[model samples]
Target: MLHRCNEQLQQFSHVNKKALDQYVNFTEQREELQKRQAELDAGDEKIKELISVLDQRKDESIERTFKGVARHFREVFSELVQGGHGHLVMMKKKDGEPADDDDEDGPREADMEGRVEKYIGVSFTGQGETQSMKQLSGGQKTVVALTLIFAIQRCDPAPFYLFDEIDAALDPQYRTAVGNMIRRLADTSNTQFITTTFRPELVKVADQIYGVTHKNRVSRVNVVSRDDALDFIEHDQSYNAE
Candidate 1:
């Protein structure tokens, strides 16, 4: 009789707990859903505000850099091209980078569009009418690229710079211009410039030459005097001619 009574009470307890389980779980589930909705609002004003401030600073920086670069570019390009003149114009290419997401700029296209997308357009007379990089001859493009590089370095100079055959496209004239430039900068400027090149012209202007040679598998660096390097190059060229 006692066993039957205990079994009946256990069954009664199971049904009562099942009935309360839904109400107990519903309270926590609703709170979590509410929290998730708040997080997923898709409107992050603080992030947007931070982005706007950064964009404004970027525009100002680019504007100042463009002015400095354009002025220097005109002078150097002229020198490099042997009486050539060019212009550097900053214009919009496309929004440099889009908003954090499409939704971030929703309904604010006009404001955000103007904030991004500034690029420099290079045009030179006598380089044909195309005024495009692709249409430019190798030497012409090298002059433009090297001029801009020097211009930027002038604007914001650091201790040293590295170059790897930056004037490989140039002919003798432009190469000499580049050599003269290297000489001038090395003699006048406090900053050191390091470059690797096969051009004898460049080696002549270089203050130091670290000749890298790979033997078997290991590379060795030979520090050669400028006078010796020039003599070696002349001898090699003469031998090649013979």
Candidate 2:
């Protein structure tokens, strides 16, 4: 009888232990579901906030784009009216930055004045050497003209460069220097150049040459090969011999 009672008590204890384990597991699963639902709600709120912020940003961006385009068109219109005679206009900075000044008009005026002075190498003071485009000699004026042209070209480079009698006023040495400079610029930028000249020395460095002349009141242009040019020079020398 005692052994039977002990076996029954052990079986009862085992069933109670299994039921307690099932209760604990059910409680844990319910807690985990609640935690997941709370997390999902938080995520939804965060996504809504982000969407609101993005909408605001999109509106701001569209406004900024339209303003930028309008400003660009205004600048283009101004340039067209000015006959494209000015240097490349860049934004002005006060104290080396855009925002260091309280006055709005100060920076623009300063930048325009600075650019004009720099382009002409002028001084605010009366003591400095004054050089004007009209007062310069032909060669000096050519140099100044070329300098201005180069400055403008640096701002906006073109596909082809045509130099018509640019070296007409230059001496032989200056002509060679200008030729070398052009060659260097062409080499670096891969720009095609067509220059008209009557000087053989200037034509010597050209890759291709076209001679333009008026014959019988008609203009004729002939593309002369390097060999033909040499032959022509030799034939002219022979004629000088006679």
Clashes in model 2: which pairs?
Answer: none
Ten residues in a row with the worst lDDT in model 1?
A: 98-107
The superposed Cα distance between candidate 2 and the true structure at residue 102, in angstroms, equals 22
Give stretches of model 1 more than 4 Å off. Answer: 1-53, 93-113, 118-130, 235-242
Could you tell me how far off, in angstroms, the CA of residue 31 lies in candidate 2 after the best superposition?
67
Q: What is the C-alpha lDDT of each candidate?
A: 0.71, 0.56
Candidate 1 lDDT, 109-221, residue by residue in tens: 23354464544344443432327677778877878788888888777877887888887788988888888987888777887878777668898777677767799999999
Among these predicted structures, which one has the highest lDDT?
A: 1
Model 1's alpha-carbon lDDT is: 0.71
Q: Give the per-residue lDDT digits (tens) of candidate 2, residues 1-242.
A: 99999988987774565777899999999999999999999999999877766655554453343334333333332332233222212223333322221222212222222322122222111113333456657975665456445544544578888889888887766667667666766788777777876445557778777766698999998998877776675676588779
Q: Which lDDT value does model 1 have at 179?
A: 87
